[model samples]
Every structure is written in structure tokens, then in C-alpha cells.
Target: MGRVPVGELSRYLLAGRLSTNGCLTSFRRTPRSRLVGPAPPTLRPLRTFHAAKEQPDPTHQQVQTPPTVPLRKKLKDEAKQARKQGKKKSNADSQTVEGWELTVGIEIHAQLNTPCKLFSSATTSFNDDPNSHVALFDVAMPGSQPIFQTGTLIPALRAALSLNCDIQPVSRFDRKHYFWWDQPSGYQITQYYQPFAKNGHITLLARDGIAPEDGKSVTIGIKQVQMEQDTAKTLAHNDNTQWLDFNRVGAPLIEIITEPELHHPRTAAVLVRKIQLLLSTVDACVSGMETGGLRADVNVSVRRTDDPSQTLGTRTEIKNLSTIKAVEDAIIAERDRQIRELDAGRQISSETRGWSIGSTETRRLRGKEGEVDYRYMPDPDIAPLVIGSDLIAHLKQSLPVTPDTELDKLISYFGLTPKDALSLINIDNGARVEYFYRVLYSVQDMIAADDLDGEGADVKTYAALVGNWTLHELGRLTSSKAGPHGTVDLTFAPDGDCAQVPDAELSQLLYHLYRKHITGKVAKELLMALYLGELEDGVRSAIDTHDLWFKEYSLEEYEALVDEVLEGEDKVLQEFATSAKFPQGKLMFLLGKMMRAGQTERIDPANAEKVIRTRIESLRPSAA
Candidate 1:
């Protein structure tokens, strides 16, 4: 077909009847109009006389010729009608694209907690010499074949099973090709088409100011969990040169992707923290983010639910956000950038962006790549992984109670609040958390015993005091020290090092305070002294040198001291009785005045308050 000029148009020629403006109309080109153009060479004049055979043809067949229309004019009329329809449809579907919505899906690649790499037996230690841990298969040397590590699979399976995901009976590996400085082979062995597990959910304890929870419960659905080999790390230089570290290459990695259910950056971080906790609980991964053991690729998107016709806006992936705070900032900044671009009537580009930690902004790195771009194929060297029912049963039986389940038990069994249970369950060390529970229960026992001994004490009050003090104050103190500064002071010792204080001793101290044997302030001072290893080591009996220190001060001796002080300062004593507010700057203050009067005898504040009250009573005039 020849190209049509812009000015040329098309007209349709119809053989059937046509309807226009509710009227059937038919027309033909007039002979006078035909004269306007040059007549065809075959044109002939009308014949006056005709042969009988030609004249009889009208009776045999009634010949009819339809008007012919130009092809260009027909095309123009069809296009005009199409354009009108298009305008009407656009008006009906129009929407305010002022704010762009981004749909984000993150694929986190975390290094598996294994002693060796996935395809090689080389040590997976991070700080070893470059290529020290690389094997023939890791570097993809010719004739060196890949082998799957059973050790790696165990931890990965444990992680998946703990997340309530099914352990597939058969899983396979594939080779994903991409060029990079660190990867000597230019390809990585990973799983793409088929993963080991799929469709799971993780419940996270949302942090304050992040979601609707405000440090409450939130659930994020997990889309998929896959096992793959990690890529080698590259250290870039200022001159654009790169140093390859093959130690990380071929290391087992488990990638967990979440559904785009998160609305805020902080919510995503909360999900990450919960996963980290669960991974730690299962002993599958460490909680350290700085060492590159764990990293996340955060996908972010936005949309307004009211508009149905509008297409979803572009999505950007925040690459390798290791720190929780950085992940949050990256999401905020990326969301704002997308909204601004839409507001300015510019389309948001779908791309992968890198987060600048120092500047705290996101910068475009590369456009998004389709699945086919990676040229993924089944890994030829390794055979298909086949898991048996027996192995699955054993794994299920061996798995510990998940953090969420344990958290619920903690709340119900120990009467802990939701917030406290969440904090306690997320601790890095499960053993420590268990020990804290033990101490809490032991303290309750002591409170009950004190009440039975005619020394009334509130269990709930003391339990709150112990729980808060241990979680906040004591935890802070222990964590601040670079080394062991003192022995562990607990209300009860659980059959271990003498470093831990016994519960009986703690109960004794509380009893003494209730009996007016020591002031609340003095009890803290003695506890600190005991924790500093000041008492005789391994002295399990409560009435040892430590108890002797509290018992030595007699009530009579303390009273006598107060009496002498009052007699020595009779003028001040009278003023204290008569004046509403006596000046104690020059005379008497708190226990400091008594301590100054008698340094040889260490008079604690508890004994002092009792002695002072006694003296004041003796000085008061008789009521009768």
C-alpha cells in the first residue's frame, strides 16, 4: 500500500441501503459531475439504434452499478467516528493522577547460618583472606562440579518450618546470570522458578509511632521463602577498581518476600525485627545487621483505593537496607519523591534505587529487569533435593515453640502484659529470658513466705518492682560494662555460678526492710555492695557476715545516740518542736547530722528515723 498524505481522506461505498438522520437515502454520481474530471478513454456516445440481442438484455437481467467512493475518504470518516468515541471514553475514565501510588515488594537475601558455603566445603568465615574460602566449584573452574550442602539445608528448613510453611518434597536449583566484579563466573546458582517454601505469615510487634499498634501487635503476610546461594561481595575503590571477596560466594541464603501489606516504613522495620527474632530463636541466623549476615530489599508502592480505572503507579525497590532505621528513612523519602513526581505531572519511573546512608536519600541505580533478563536455567550439576516424610516429621517435632506462641504463654502463665511479653520474647538470648522468668517466680514465692511469717508483704507490688528493675535498670547496667564488673545479683540462683545471688538472701533483705530493720534506700545500697563481690563468696546462709552487718545496730544504742544529740543541741531541739520550719543548716538535717556526730557507729537511716521519732515523742508535753 502507498503512504497516504495528511490532507487525503477516505470515503466508504455501500452496496446496501444506508440510513442517515432516521431516513434511508440512496445517491449516485451524476453524469455532469463526472464531466468535472477527465472522462475515461473508453467513454462512448449513446446509440440511437441498437441490435435486437443488446436491446433484449434489459429483459433478461436488470443491470445496476453502485457508486464508487474514494478509499481515503472512507478511512477519514471511520477515523472521525473513532476519535469521538475515544474522547467520550476518556472523559468517563478520567481520574486525578496528582499523587502517584507505589506498590513495593521486598526480596530479602539473608546469609544462612552454616559453617560452610552451599556448594563448597570451604569455611564461610567472613574475615578470612580473599578467596581463602573459595573452592573450585565456587570459582566455577572447569571440571569442578557443584554439590548441595546438607548442613545448609537443615538450617534453612528449620527457618521455613518455624514460619509455618510447608517443606516441599522436591526443590531444585537454577543458575541466574549477571555480570559483576566479585562473581568470577558471571553467574550465580539460585532458585528462581521453584522455591523450597511458599505462603507463610509472620506476626510482628509493631513499634511506637509506626503503625496503628503503637508498640502493639501487627501481622504481615509472607509471600514466599526461597533458598538460594549468595553472591560474592565487592569492595569498590575510589579509582573505580573493585576487590573481589569469594568467601561469601556460594554461601547459602534464604530470601523471604512479604506481600505489599505495609503502608509505612516503620511498619516494614517492625516486620524485619520480628523475622530477625524468629530466625535467632531457631538458631538459623544471627541478629547482627552490620556484618552483612542479614539484609533486605524493600519494595514500596502507593495507591488511592477510590479510583478503579487508573493504572497503578510505578514501584521502586530500596536495595540492601540493612539497618532498621535506614529502611524507615528510605521508605519515607522514596514515597515522598513518588508523590512529588505525580503532582508535577511527571510519570514516576519504575526502577531500583540505592539508599545513601550518609545523605539519607534515595538515588536511582538501574531500571527494573524482567524475569527473562536473568537467563535462568536449571543448575546442571546438582541433583533435585528430595525430602522424606520421616525427616519432615522429625523436624516438626524438634522445632521449638515459635516466638509468638511463647509470647502468648508468657502472658497467660506469668500474668505479664502484652507489651512486656513482646519485649521479653524478642530478646536475643532465650536462656536469659527464661532465667528472668525463673527469678520473677522465685520472688513471688518469697513474698508469700514473708506473709506466712507474720511479716505482711504484697507479691504483686514486689513482682512489678523486680520485673521493671531487671528489664530496665539492671539490663542497662550489665550491658554498659565492657567486661564482667560484678557478680550477677538475682533473687534466686539457678544451680550455676556463685556469681548469681540466691533468692533466699533477697527475701531476707526484703523481710528486714518490712520489719524496720533497714530503710528502702539502705536496701539498695547493700544490694549493690553484695553485687560488687563485697560479701564472703559462696556464703549461702542468709545470716552470714552480710546479715551480721544489718543486725549489729541495736535499737537501744541508736536511741541513746539520738538522745545525746538532742541534749547537746537543746536550743535546736526546742526550735524543732516549736517552729513550723526549723533551720537545720547549722544544727540537724537528715542522717548526715547523726553520721557526723558519731562516725565510729554507722547509723543507717532506718534506725535513725525510729530513734528520732522516739526522742521527739519523749520531748512532747503530756496530753493530760
Candidate 2:
């Protein structure tokens, strides 16, 4: 009888070659091991919180009786049953608030925007044919070795720097073992004991779009920013059999772990959004949660709000929450569930859960996997990665400003209000932010060139106006729902609803407003025409072609227009007059009717508003 190594038994077992009779089954090279040496008694010490656990040898395993409930396949059957019979349909069991404080910590896995797999030359592509991008190492072929990718480090470091993390001088990879079809290697290579970077903090300020009114700062401590390879994705829930897609396998990933400081679900959501922006800003990762390029795992627990000790409760993790909305909803549901259970004198179990889109609640995935369950061990093949000071400095110097910094700069430098600043920076669809700056500078350049013609218009006022028009006029057209999704550099769109907002055309439109040539209403018309791809003739030409230039209306014309509006909307005018105080809303409503009755180009909004108020006051006294 030949001795079978306990550590290598899983490989043979998975291959259906291992028998209780105990004949040694082996390979020429055991999965990339350069030399196949005699098997040792054990791989290493497996640590447990309670005691050191012994590794089980397959030959000495005891056969136990089967359980009552049948498991055709552990993953498949459970998911099938769950989908067949939905859980917890009672709306009457609504979440009861027991004053239990919720604590949430999140682990975000963002796929780094790299050209190739982390340790293989296989190129990365989304929604590609299955196994199309796979390398020998990705499929865990025997004798295949991991070739360390230097390209991944640039983006990894960029991610770390964006989060204000301290880079570790040296870091090593570890193996997290789990026997699953998705991970054919049986062990995922990751950074565990020593990660790439750590001790980072992302401060969420009011301007960071988290707490706009609270005026308080929330600093989320990043425990670790580790570079890891993603596992192959498995599609099992909707189908009877498991389907493995290896395209995503061995893709570069950066796992960012945050300390459990977040209490509110909305803040947790904002934090995720902030991190998403940061990663994208630094060119580290493509932050598309819907596309599975980015995903989050929230570790949530509830504690007594009034408790003096402030001890954390037993936590259950909600895994792979794809959207920020899902992250918040899952945390809220989980916290509520725990509160309800505690109120009923039931213990909250620590486990891994999944978010059900249909039920809109957290469902149990499995028992919580502890550190011992993972059986982490350092990779023997890969050497420890060392980051030189020069490399760190080089990447640091090139790091772009994160979203929050850019937000502040827009407010302070461009004189944009926080509301307007947020609107510009957080446009989901296009490069409207860049479009804004381009138009701003173009108008400013025109002002600089023709100082006498632009006497009344200052650069700061132009900046404010530019921000306004970009958000309202420009952004209204080039929205996420409507595209010319701003794919090309300066050219946003060729011709569509969200056509290209060429700086020259937009700047000329603004210049007309600055030069007192057109009212805002007329300018908006021209802006819409630009959206219709009519700006090819130029803003100046369109204004000339349509006779859309501004004209001054006399006091009599304003009064006549006001009187015509009053006669048509007499009921609304009566409503305004009957109000105890001056109804500014009603006054504006009437003013809008008068302007739309046809004289937007001649009637300035400010003068028109003044005339309407005075006329309304006169009418009120006469009616009295």
C-alpha cells in the first residue's frame, strides 16, 4: 500500500480516482509544482478560534447516515427549492424598530481596468464567448505556472492612492481553499495576512454628496486594499445544472475592506458611490456595479443604541450586492430582520445571506465561513511582491484628483454652488463635466480676446452661467437615458437627441447672452436646436437665420402683454388676489403664461416678473 498525502487527496477525489481501498493516485506534476516530491504528513497548521484542528485524511473518514432532506446537489437543489417556494411573504411582519443601532462594514471587489488577466496573458473581455479568454493557468491545467503581471500593479497602486492608503513595502499572496465548480483550482489566490495597501481613509463630507445638510464629516477607514484574482463566475440559481464561465476567472481584482463605522444605509450607499467614483477617477477600475465589474459584500449587525459598552452584535454578511440600492435595501432588511428576531426573543444567526430581488430581502446562502474554514496558506510558487520607493513616488505624482477634490475645486475656483457642482461632476451618462469646462474656457477666451465687447460680462459670472446652462440646457439633452453617450473626445455626438455640444457653438450662445443679444428663453431654443444637430450651421448663423436676436419691449407692450395674460387666466389671477399674502408661486405661474403667450425674445424674465407683480397688486385692490 502506498501512502496518499492527506493534502493532495482532494485532487484525486474530485477526479473520481480516490477509493477507500487506498491506492495512491498521482500526476506527473501536481498542478504547476515544478518537482513532485514525496507527500508530507500535512500541508501546514490549520488554526481554529477554539483549538487547532487536525486535517482529515480521506482513508480515515467515517461514513455517516444521510439526512432526512435530500440534497441532489448542494448548490442546485437549495436554489431550486428557494425559487419554487418563496420565503417570508407576510407584509404584516414589517420591520419593528427596537432602537437597535445598525453597524455596516463593506467589502468592495472592483475589477481593475487592466488589459490582461492578473497572472496570465489571456485578454479580458466582457460578455465574450465562454472559455474564449482562458489561459492554461486560468483553467488550472497541470504544470501551468502563474506569470506575474506587472501591468496590474499600476492600477492597483492607483486604487490604493485614490483611497489615501499607505502602500506596503512588501506583500505576499495566500491561498483561500474552497471546493467548488466555479473555482476548479480549489484555492483562490488572494492577499490575506499581508495585503498590498492598508490604513486608508475616505472622508465623506457634505460636499462629497453624502450629508449635504448635516455639515458633518464621515471618515470611513479602509482596513486593507488587497490585489487578488477573481474566481470563475457560476450561473446556478436560474438553472438546474451549474454553468461555469471562465472568462472572468483570473481577472485582476482589488478588494477594498472598510472598517465597520457606517450606521445608516444611505451613508453606506454614498460611501460605495464615492469609492466607485474614486476608482474610476484614478483609472484603476471601471465602476459599473450593474455589469458585475464592481460588486460589494456588506457585513451588517445591530446593537442596542443606548448600550454603554457599544459592543457589536453577531453579524451576518450579505454577499454580492450588485447595486448601491441593493446594498442599502439588504442592510435595512437584514437589520430589521435581526431586530424583529430579537424582539421575539430569538437569536440572530451569524451566516452568509443573499439578496432576493423578487422578495426584496436577504436569504440565507450558507453558514458563516470563518478563517479556519478557508484554510489560508501562503502560495509557494509566487514570490513576495516588493514595491520600490521610486515606483510609489512615480504613481503618486501621476494620481488624478478624486471626485471630492474635483467637487471642491469646481465650487471654489469656478464659483459654482455646491448643488450645481454636484450636478456637473456626478453626471452618469456623458463627459458633460469636460464639456462644461470647455465651454467655460472658450467663452472666457472670447472675453479675453474682445475685452471691450465683453465689458459687462465678468469671467466669474460667465462661469456660473456656464454651469447653469450645462446642467439644465446641455445636460437635459445629453442625459444617461438619452445619448450621444459622449464616447468620443470633444465630439459628444454626431447627430441625435444628445448631439455634440461643440464649445464654439455653446460659447457663442453664452456670448450672445453676455453681449445682451438674446434672452435666456431664446438661447434655450438655440441650445435645443443644437441637440437636434442644427448647430452645424453655427450658433451665430442660426441666430441670424431665424431672426432669434433679443429686442427691448416698451413699458406699454409689457403692460399690454400682462393685461392679455390677466384676461385669459382670470381664474388664476383671482386665486392670486384672494390669497392673504402675496402668492409668489401664483405670480410666477401667471408670468410664465404671459411669456409663453408669445413674447419670450423681447420680454426679459426679470422685467416681466416685476410688471406682473405690480399689475396683480393693482387688480387686487380694485377687486377689493
Candidate 3:
């Protein structure tokens, strides 16, 4: 066979299944040394697994490499040592409240963007039908063993690194015993004893989407990040009957736990938003929380600031908050509830609660579960997840630029305002920023090739022009008509190309503006025409065709008028060409005559001189 269709292959084969001691071992991309038998010659390119049981099982290669140290570990150690050796001062933000201090933590459950579930080969898509993507292992059928998908491990590692978490060289999964409608298995497979990554931090800045007046520049410490499976969603009907959607069952998830350091609800909201942006930027997690890609458990407790006691108050957790706003509101509600309870001389109780729509009140779901409630044990089917230090180092060097990196480039290199740069960085998953850069560089190249004859273009000043057009003008045009996803047509072609504005047409518009061939008003008119199927030709010809060119003369018109002035000054042209550099005084004198002849004072004196120089060079012969 020449080639095999991907759909034709069974998911078991795609999952890299092997028979070892009558159980399934799911791993792929091995280093080729552990193969017990030679690979089939015909399907060597496809995934090949060994059935004989001599080699160890893992997520990938299991080299004898030590775990990579998290960057925050050293900083945490130093901070601890300093606090132990010296007196500690109360952190202002953490202990801000007078006579009352509210402490909060968050556990965010973000789904990894894997095509399939972690243990099963079932696709991880949201389907309406119950059990649409469930497999035997996902449903906990007897004698069904799980094979770990390597696709799940890479993104988790990337997210860990991005958040400054250390990767454990050897991480294993555990089983937490529970009985619920969602979990068909009595126990859930999770990482309890050894988390994948730990000891990370995410910093919230005062600007770039956050409020400047708040003046926040605090780093919230990350306690741990673990990998686990999601339970089925319990959907209830109008008749009091409920159905379990196993389509969402057994999906891969990363639980990011934060230290109880947040004191403000706004700050907690900002932290969740920051994590969403970071993980999505690195291609780790899906960005939208409303679509169930991510959710959070907001935990809060209130303690008396007047009391210097080491013991804190009872904390309550609001579970499965699907929106960032919900996280903020829930924390605020819980904190206020605790404070009120304390004011009435009542003790706060620990419980898990759910938030309602637009209300500051929370409904209790259950009492908080401790270790004894869910009997935690090691998962027998899956083996330890082994990762090599070499792979970690390579991935570190290959990490893509985050939003902060792009923001700095726009502000420092392009001289854009922070607000303007952030506007670009914060939209359409960075497509707006990408589009702006494309338009700018394309215009720069166009002008360099057309105007400078491949010489030094040096169009840094035009960046402001590009910024204004991209941020204000393009945005205005795109929002004029609402299309799919509440988007107006971007490409201005009425016949067809009425979707996104292509970078080339935008480059052409900017080029015309840069050369002053068309005024700002004319360019805006041309853009509207381009959007509305009014412009007949390209930006260059459209200006003249629509009688929209400004009073300023074109380069050709300026050169033609300069030729008339140079006709009477033959000796001037000869001396100007013979000299190593043209004299400034003589050039200005000639430029004045050229402007007078053209009857236009709108042209730049520098541009007028350029016309004169070119005309003079052409008049004189090229020397050998």
C-alpha cells in the first residue's frame, strides 16, 4: 500500500497501544532502541509499537535525566531564608484592610487543546449527543485499559514553562475515589502526590488592560499545576430528569492552583485573565472561558486584621466559575459574606458553593472534601510520565513570543503609545497586532522599492501614520457592517473579497499617504470606496480617477515643472552635475523657480529640490 487514510486507522493503533503482561501500554515517539521487534516494513512511517515487555513505559523518552528546577524555586528559597533570618514586614497589599483582612486563592481548570482525550482516543469536541465520543476505557468498561496520549503532555509542559513552573522528570497519576453521576468510574485518575509542575508565579501590571490608578504590580505565587480528567457534565431537563453528557467525560484538564495571597477581587480577576492570555498565547489552552475551555474555583476567607493570631478564618470555595467577571464577583460576595458573619459574631463555615447569575449570593453545593472523603490511590493502568531535561531545554529555547514581548516591540521599536500597542495586542487572539505589523512592513517595502530605487527607505516617521490608520481608520471601516461573528467585511471588494482587509491593499493606501500623493481625507474616501465597491482601480490610479488627489503636485508633475525652469539655466545644470555635491543655496533658488513654474506652493522644498536634482542628472550625461 502506498498511503493509508488517517480515518481508516483504528484509534487504538493511533493511540500507540501495545500488549505488555496482558495490559495496554500507550506511548509513542520512542527513541527506537526499545523496540522488541523490527517495525513492519510497509507501515514503518506510521506509529509502531512493541508488544514484548522489556522496556519501561512512559509519556515519551525516559532518559536518565534529572528534573529541571523551576525558576521560582530559588527565589522562593531566598525569600524564605531572608524571612527566617530577619524580621518580616506585613505586605501592604496582602494586609490592606483595616481591622479585617480577606485572603483569597484560585484553582483554575483549563482544558488543554488536545484533539483527543488523554487516556482514550475519543475526540475532545463538544457534541450534543450523550456519549458521542466515549470509548470503552472512558466509560470504565471492565478489562478496558487506558493508553496515554503524548499530545496531552507537550502543551502542559509548555504552559508550565511559560508560568515559570518546574517540570518533574518523573510524574505519575493517582486515583481519587468518588461516586457521582458524572464520573462513571468510582475513582478519578489525577495527579495527587506528584504534580506535573509547581512553584510558579504570574505578575499583574498596572497598565496594559489593567487600571493604572490601581497601581498594581504584584506577583501571585502558583502552588501547583496538575493534569487530570474532567467529569461528564450533568444536564437536567425540565421534567426533573437528568442526562449525563459523556461527550465531555474524560477530557484532559490542567488544574492551576494559586497560593492564598490575593486580597482584592479585582486583582484576582486580573490574574485569571493574565493566565488565560499567557496559556493561549503559548498554544497551551483554549482562550474562551464562556465556551467551557476554562473555569475557576474562587476560594475566599476573612480574618480580623486587629487580631495577630496565626490561625486564619474558615474559607469557602465557589466552584466552576465560567467567566472572569464571575470570579471577581464571587470572591467579592464570599468575602463580604464572611465579613458580615464575623461582624455578627458568627463563625464562617467551610463549604463548596456555586454562583448564580448577577447575584452576590452563593448557594452551597457541598461541604469541602478532604483527603479522607476521596480515597486517593495510585492509578494502576497508566505509568509514570517521564520527560528528559534535554527536551525541556530545547522547548525553553523554542518558546514563542508572548503578548508582553509583542507589546514592547510595538511601543519601543515602533514608538506607539502603550494604549495603542495594547489595543493591538488584546484583540482577535493577536491577529490585530499581526495584521498591523503586516500592513506596516508591507508599506515600508512598497515605498522602498517604488520611491527609493531600492536605496535607504528609512520610514520610521511613517510608523505613526501606519499606527493611526491601522488602529483608528481600519477599525472604523471593519465595524461599519456586522457580518458573521459580529464582524463587518474587512476586504473592501464588493464583488467578493469582502471579508478581512488584505495587507497588500492596506499597504498601498499607506504608501499613497506616505508619498502625499493623496491627502488624508482622500485616502479615507478611497478606503470607504474600497469597502463599498466604489473604487475602480488601485490606490495610485484611484486617486486621480476619482478626482481625489490633493492640491499637492505628483512627483512626475514636480519633475516636469522643474525641467521648464532648468531649460533657461544650462550652465547651472552642468556645474550641479560636475560638483561632488549640489550646493544648497543654488538648489533652493532653483526649487523656488520650479514651484513658481508649477504654480503650486503645497510641495515640500526638500521634495522640490529632489525633482530638480533628478532633472539635472538626466540633462547631463553619465560620466565613464
In terms of lDDT, the best-performing candidate is: 2
Q: Flag regions of model 2 displaced more than 4 Å.
A: 1-98, 209-215, 235-239, 453-456, 478-499, 554-598, 607-624
- Cα deviation at 203, candidate 1, in Å, is 3.0
Error (Å) of candidate 1 at residue 317 is 0.8
C-alpha RMSD (angstroms) for model 3: 33.4
Model 2 has how many clashing residue pairs? 0
TM-scores of all predicted structures: 0.64, 0.73, 0.68
**Across residues 1-624, which tens digit of lDDT does each residue of candidate 3 receive?**
234345433323543323321212223323357757654321121232344434544765645544433435656888899987885333223223458777889999989989989899999977556777889988899999988999998899999998999888899999999898889888888899999898998877766444333475888899989999999988888989998888888899999999998877777887888788788778898655867898999889988876677577888999889887888777767776778888998887788989986875788899989898998989888899998999899889989897777777888888888888877665555566667777888887777676745565555578878888877887777563423332454532212222445667778988877877666666777777666655556666776676765576778878677768878786777787677765667777887787677755356666777777776667555675
lDDT per residue (tens digit) for residues 1-624 in model 2: 566677456434333233334433233224456455655332211112246665666798654533323223555788888976986534223222456677889999999989999999999867788888999999999999998899989999999988889999999999999988888799999999999899999988866555332247888999999988898877775658888899989999999999998877777888998788788677788556867789999999987878769879999999998887787678778988888888899998889999966456688999998999999999998999999999999988998766777887888888999888876765542256777877888888877887766564546778998888877765555455445643332234312122356677888999889767898778877876776776677989988888988887888999888878878676877776687777888887887887898566687888888888887787675643
Pairwise TM-score winner, candidates 1 and 2: 2
Residue 57, model 3: Cα distance from true site in angstroms: 99
- Please list the residue runs of candidate 3 whose C-alpha ends up more than 4 Å from where it truly belongs after superposition: 1-97, 127-130, 208-216, 450-460, 478-498, 529-541, 552-624
Q: Of models 1 and 3, which has the larger lDDT?
A: 3
Q: Total backbone clashes of model 3?
A: 4
lDDT of each: 0.65, 0.78, 0.75
| Top-scoring candidate (TM-score) | 2
